[model samples]
Target: MAESTTQRTAGSAPKVQLSCEMCRQRKVKCDKLSPCTNCQRLGAVCIPVERARLPRGRFRKSKAAHRVPESDSADATDELKGRMERLEGLICTLMQDNGAAANTIVPAMADAGILPSPCNTESRSDLPWPVGNDVRDGGGLVAQKPSAYLGNSFWEGLMHVQNRPLRNLTDQRHDGATFAPYDILVHGLTGRALLSPLCSTTEPWATPQLQQHLCHVFLSQVDPVFKILHQPSLRAFLIEGKPYLHYDAHRPAPEALRCAVYYTAACSITEDQWPPAIGASRASIIARYQRETEAALVRAEFVTSDDLTVLQAFVLSLIGARSQDRSRRAWTMLSMAVRVAQALSLHVPDPPFLITAFEQEMRRRLWGAIGLLDVQASLDRASEPMILRSWLELHAPLNVSDDDIPFGHEIVPAESDSFTDSTFTLMISKAQCAVRSLTEPGSQYMHIRQACVADFQQTASQLLRNCQPDAVPFHWYTLQVADYIAASMQLIALRPLQRTPDFTPPHVSGSNLLRLSVDILQKTETLHSDPRGHPWRWFEGIFVPWHALAVAIAELCGCEDAALIERYWDTVEGAFERFGGLVADEKEGMLWKPMERLMGRARAKRDTLRVVFTPESASAQSQSPFLPVMTPDQNQHQRGMGLAITPCSSTSGSIGVEPWANVPTVWDEVDFGDVGIDQLSWTNYQDFMEDMQR
Candidate 1:
């Protein structure tokens, strides 16, 4: 029965052994599955007892059936449930701790490119870290813990904890909160490509966004061409789109053009790499010339004589430089002297004698530089016959006739040949020479005086014979000739009075001279008094002739007849006062003051005469050299030879007035012999002669 029972027991028992749950948890082997299938069905771990030495003759029962009693089963089950619950809670706490540690390690790992995008499981838990076991113990679960961070978790943890403060520090460092979003986007994109794993995905070919960004960067780098062209207008148009197309066209504004030219010239001097030797040499030469010229002007201020040869030489040098290649740089420097001369002529502060000489010098330099023949070309281009006539009237006294004078070259026959026009060319050239000579000192005055007389006679004869009495245009020309005649007569009168006071009078009578003087005075009064007269119509044209007449009449007042002299004086005073008022009306500020001074001088002279002499004060007049008509022997010769009975000389005292005293006058008082009329005329004649010789 025992044997049968053993067989049943062995047949009923399970064949395979099972491990205890503790040894199996640790992966060790076990003898049997104590409480294995049954415990498993009950949701309990199977545990086996250790093998023990058996007592002699005693049978051992499996301790597995000695499980808790039925009454204590509930208690044991409760206790097992509590222990399992506690163990599970401990494992969860450990898992939470491990996940937090991983979170700290992952960022640096990703930065180093050692961790994958989504980290593997082994990478998460391999702390102290086995290769591919990246899980750290302190922080939260992190998928991609960088290999770099895993090397030092303590440092990584501090860095992770310090993120907000570091961010604050970065914001303070860059002051980046003030930056615009576009700026931030640009910086962030750039940094990500430099620092992140995404760099590997970046394409070599330019994308649309990349192209746009590159273009913006390139445009920011270069200066705008239009901005360079219109520098002054840059600020006004910078923000305007399509500035080049929409802005005003660059027509150089006058101020901008002037400034540009000046600046360009200045920059050329400054920036050009001129040879040091040449630049220094040129600068020194310029400085010396300036110093010398200034010194010359200073010397000229105190000089009493009218010789302008030094100044002329300086001016000629300047003009000669103009046609030369090297002299371009001297143009501005030369203009300075020319301007000074122009100013001096316009404002004549020098004595009349000196002023006359300076004006002649100015004309000489101006005409000489522009070739002599060019003056004729200028006159030939005149559009109006009246203009030609007026020009001749003002200038012809200094000119001579073509037949009497030598012209350097004759006009070719192929061109239009008018005798009058050819005569006009000769006239202009002669006039220019005459003006030049007049300005130079130590020039002979006799020939100029004679040429002036001859010119006056020729002009007067032509007008009186050819001009119709009613021809208004021709009248002014006749009047100008008459003025020249009067001026010539006055000069002739002054010559004998100055050098040879005791000389016998000429055959010409003072009465005839008086008649000529009265005629001119009456004509001038009639022409000026009538506003419709040609002289009044073209006032500027008549100013020079009128002034000459005034001077001539003033000299004429020194005649023999008291009544006529008084009449001449009154006439001049009235004419000058009227002219002075007209000058004021014209607002010709430059001429008005000089005209005023002349009028004032005339007034003072007239007032002095009124207070000194009565209406019948002729007898009180002194016996002067002008009183003797002819010496006794000269009178007898005229009577005996059946010669024409010469009229009483101005020296004769025939009208019961002593010869008019030849008072030292303005004309003779100033010794312009160094710069006189005759000398000027001879110089001009010589120049003409030289040109003929050439």
Candidate 2:
């Protein structure tokens, strides 16, 4: 195909004119080349926007001039081959210069079937992420239905536009000349890429002996916190080996299970527990295991399959999430697990025929556990529970042991009711009820919040009533700790009722809240002081009691009542000492930053009021106030949320511009001390509504 001789002679031969579309859109002058000046300056695509200027009445006088001469018509075909070659050469150069841009353009060339184009022809093959697909029918490693693409006319028009560059000095089109094509095609096509391979990096699979050992340790140590998996099935699966594999396309991958086991096991290990000759300490080893677990999950193709292992892995992943600083990622991952369980209708009883009674029971247990997690996550992050409150049909797990059901058994009938899970569900329902009723309250929430005190305590007491001497150590530990957790949760749930603007003299005022917090803390302290209490220091998330302690100390320091402050000061001091002591041995600042800051504030309080202590009280403590902790800083870069106040001087971590940040927010004096954050964030409030609606 030849360019029209008249058109070329009128524009290119004499003097170029007209600005490119890109320049016009950008409101700039264009050099008007195929790859024009403004596009070059901006590294953008340039296509000419045809001007509709007909030269006014110039057309009437130029009717003869518009006609092509015989010489130009005859010679038009002579330059056709040369022009075609030049155009082809320019295209090839652009393609090479912008190989990545070819990916965006390539989709237009071939169909989705042609993904990971044969033309990726680069020497490198190992890409960290997947490349886009190319045209193909159904036969391929992974099928792509198709892709949306701009037409060939659009591409051709963009790459090569009419209207030559104006050469006139006064013409704005004659400005600059350069062009660059930058492609974010990878990001655009990222949706189609399977991320499983990216999650492929994993630790070596553990030996059978190690796997068994870890499984035993995990069951004994971690299962009580989130009992999502069936112990009997897990034990048989680990011990009986080949019998456990699912005969289906979506069988649970061992790698994901391995991750779940290893991650749980990480919680139990300590520096002293690690074997000698291991250069790294316990924390490093645990972190390595966590990374491996994530990698294995990615490789397991968890998202595409309805595998039970993946759901359990997500639960374990959530346990690990609390260690992360203010991360919401776990909430998102937990939502996926909730969705998967709901999809399988674990919320309802398992269907009659497709699965055995054992599997049916297992599903029920997992579903209930998932609910507990969903509720907690929602409460912690101040998000609505993912499980639609009204649709929940989930029931309690059977109160039986793994030993109750031997391998190859269809199902084990419950001999007695297990209050552990059943009561847990009831209390969770109550807690959820407390949460929902509190959100943007009505008169009804008042009655409900008032009842939380008795309801939470009664339910908590019942939940712990099933323990026997012969029961597993971890099981007993979980029940005991749960009693404490429920007490703390009650305090959290009732906190909002302390501040009802519409109602006078709320159920729990600042004084009562302080008393309740101290009560919970004292109970936690007692349970913690017992022989098994050593593990309380190591427990993560809900079991940690940071909220209870934070409120207690804040109230203790800010309290106006001399009697309350005097009476609770020692407990507040003791709690602070315990937390501070825990973090003091670390090479790093602390395991959790919020704890560190809380401890710091506590010390500041003691220091600020050291003189107020009586001689008798002073004799029981150090004569001088605790020295103010100076946050070390090279440039004082340490910064994040959670701390209500911190040292000023953005460049300095120690000392402050003001005595306090915004003003000392005293507990009980402020709404936080009254209602707590859960009520404010609408998490605990949602739970209240869920409970009542139930």
Best candidate according to TM-score: 2
TM-score attained by model 2: 0.54
lDDT of 1 by residue, 1-694 (tens): 6445333443354454445656555454544656655455657666664422322221224323333334356655665554444333322222333455445645465456544323343343322111122321110112333333234443453344334221233244335345343223322322211111111112221122322322232122111100012222222222231232132332112212222222121112211222343323333323322322322232233122123332332333232222121212333334344444334342233324433332332343332333232221221211111112222233222222223222222331232222221222233334434333322232234545445544544534443332322334323333333443334344343232112213222222233333333334444444443433422222221222232333334344333344445545555555555554333123243334444444454456556666655656644443231232234544533221111111121222121221112211122223333433333222322332232223
How much is the lDDT of residue 46 in candidate 1? Answer: 68
The per-model lDDT (C-alpha) reads 0.32, 0.47
Model 1 regions more than 4 Å off = 1-440, 455-536, 539-542, 545-562, 581-605, 608-694
Measured against the true structure, the TM-scores of the candidates, in listed sequence, are 0.26, 0.54
lDDT of 2 by residue, 642-672 (tens): 1112112121222122212211111222342
Clashes, model 2: 30
